[model samples]
Target: MTPAPPKNFHTSNPETETAIDRTIPDFPAAQLSDEDKYFTHHKPPSYLPDLEDEVKEFIEYHQRNTHKRIVLVTSGGTTVPLENNTVRFIDNFSAGTRGATSAEYFLENGYAVIFLHREFSLLPYSRHYSHTTNCFLDYMTEVNNKVEINPQFADEMLIVLRKYKQAKESNSLLSIPFTTVNQYLYTLKSVSQIMEIVEKKAIFFLAAAVSDFFLPQSRMPTHKIQSQESGGKLEVNLEPVPKFLSRLVDNWAPSALIVSFKLETDNSILIKKAKNALDRYQHQLVIGNLLQTRKKEVVFVTPSGENSWIKLTDDQISKEVEIESLIIPRVIEIHTQWIENK
Candidate 1:
């Protein structure tokens, strides 16, 4: 005779339990909005505690110098995992060129930078050599059994290296990486809250290309889906990602100067959508750029209905001048004016 099952174990029939487990219930539409339910139901990332500690330390270090303004620059793209175990994922398109370049300029303008970026994306200083046709090895040479920067690239590399070292020595640049959308959201919220110590001196540059939709954790499969079991055709249902910009503005870092980027394929509706975001979020500025012309031009949209275009001249483009070089200075000007007005 077998020993009795534990008292805590369910005595329900196996078939009934299996049937109930297969049914995934939809969220109640009348009770709560998806956004509200998201935070309530979803669990925070496992690495959040470690991330918070690092951010707190970084912020505390800068707080010692009251005059130092800190900018939290988010870069690259977030991924939406298809499964709980994460065999496949949906990703946004961003090489982190804008955020990385903007960060260097922010540092040059005497701001401590907290770079919250997607894992493995291009980074400042190193970004100059990454994601290019040539490999990093192409810029290296082995002479007298010692490795050195190739002579052709040494001059440019030297300038970037000096700035990079300066930033490191001053302890002004803090880099934090996130991979999935969940991790990104958690990290952003935690970092922003910690930045409250700096109050009006903080700036949030939200340049990351975040996904508009994602599979909720409750509905995700525990293991990777087998193609054979599904008859070779796969269908996925995704829910709209919460609009957290409003939360960021109203709750997270209310006093911080917030700047968001809008990239669109259509020129006619770009300004309209940008203005909508500004009105909706009540943020300071929206930087709008077309997908095709983002490298050469961008429009600055403000909450007060002020719209201005920042474009690179033909000569500037030919000279390989990055548009962020111009974008950052204008942003700094606006930030200064905003701080003074407040």
Candidate 2:
């Protein structure tokens, strides 16, 4: 028998700013939202079908180029919504500082990034990245991939890539941003698709705090704390958190070098859980952390059962030095070794 969904499942609300209660609503929808509505092709999340054609052209265009590899990294936490058309919700305390900061490190180390960002995160979108395209084939190739990720992120990346391709101007690569969990999933799927055809071994940072649970439907009525009847009778039904990893590892990125994270309520149980994460997903690595902590001290667990811990004491060491300095390089180094072994 399946477990019931939580009462509180707050999803991303792009607008409608209000104080976050981290509380779930008290009602249940008999029917869930039609997942097909969100997708370009009527599926949950969405897919960019044009990305493959672009990657193929890009590979041929850069057949003799000296580029080592193209890396796609996703960072930031996901929000939990009480219902689909999210008004009141629950979300992680994460500000997306770690993921965004780490993205900068990846860019500095010379990896082209599909840096998926959430709103109000550390990294702001960079226009400089849009000015680096050198040719039609080159621009079209990468733009094609960028465009398919999600219109929100693709728009920015495409603008930068297109401008550079047409003007033959050199510019920095961009950090493609998205607003909500749905957008993140769509973009992640697109990047995974691009990496496969290009023969690129991607370094995915499942740093985003994806809500483990989702509400039954979006159009459910706004839950009222003060009910019309107070006689101790309420019926609320729920669904489980969407299984992102099952689809990502098993189907989308079967051979990619994947890194996952596990957040535990108990620190003592973490090591065991980290090891379990590695075994469960067959990922290259698994990072574990305790829930609700100021310091994001994490344990990096390898598939062979090796584990490493990084404690920052505080996320920001100096004015300019942030947590990403400690994290991104480790990811790059691990990714480097993983590719070499293959």
Candidate 3:
């Protein structure tokens, strides 16, 4: 279940409480067209080559053999470093539950999954037992120098273990990890380009809580900023991240079906903002969710200008059925239609 909305959460009109966070710097006014400058400022992640290799191998093998649909699921929260060394940073609020769970459903529906998630966040299959309240050790007990699952949790653990093992044996899941927004952007571009080989069969489900503000390399200090500066008060200036969704749609993977997420605190403008994004990015779908009610409800806005909702029933919640179990099948139906139209 999703958490309750924060006490400060409001339902003011758009004019009063805009969905966008103003503290995050707006898109560059002077150099709005300089996409290359953004990439040059934040260097690529160190693991780019290895990540690309894995994605390439996965895509090639699937396209050659099964030729089944492929979905790229980006999850978790991305961080924005304040300094080059990165002692302090800003973080987005996400545990990656939506993305990770969705990946398992995609795989179960016969699609190979490429899961790109924030480091140390929840993972598919293992998420049920790896959360903060529970750990792997909690479900295991060692006796006679042999480790066995605790009897109480054994039934559920065995089921998850079997699914995880099956995915591993079939080589249907490829996991790539990232921590910062810089790494996420580079990895996303690389993955999109690689997945282009699948043509219309590729789907991009971008559920990551990406940061809106970042300290540019040019403005960031080489070392950590000390607390003594300015009487123990620090002032930070950040720049808005470059818009790359358009590039993903028009250049990197033109034929792919892209579904971007729009997370908002206010329900009033949730569908409004989601529709705006579909118009702006020309993507296939936008999944609109509220910060507090995300796991229980979501609004789907498509290019056809229809706004539909998926809500979890009280019975479903009581039965321990996840909302993703409903979201993924609807998405698969949309993807099937997309392929047929192509």
What do the candidate models score in CA lDDT, each in turn? 0.85, 0.55, 0.84
lDDT by residue (163-279, candidate 1, tens digit) is 999999999999999888888887787788789778888999999998999898889999998888778988999999999898788866888899999999999999999999998
- Model 3 lDDT vs. the true structure? 0.84
lDDT computed for candidate 2: 0.55
Summed over model 2, clashes come to: 20
- Looking at model 1, report the run of 10 residues with the lowest lDDT sum: 1-10
Model 2 bad stretches (over 4 Å): 1-68, 83-85, 124-172, 218-237, 291-296, 312-321
Residue 175 of model 1: what lDDT?
A: 95
* TM-score of model 1 vs. true structure: 0.89
TM-score of each: 0.89, 0.62, 0.89
lDDT of 2 at 223: 60
Q: Per-residue lDDT tens digits of candidate 2, residues 1-342?
A: 111211112323333122221221221233222321232221223223343344434433333353535555555666645545556565665666556556556656755555566655545234333223543234343354563343445576776456445322222233555555665666665556545543435566777777665544453456643345657664445455555565567655666677777877887898898787677767778878787652457778887666788866542544435555676679778887877887
Candidate 3 lDDT tens digits, 148-209:
88999889778899999999898899999999998898889778877887889999999999
Model 1 clashing-pair count? 0
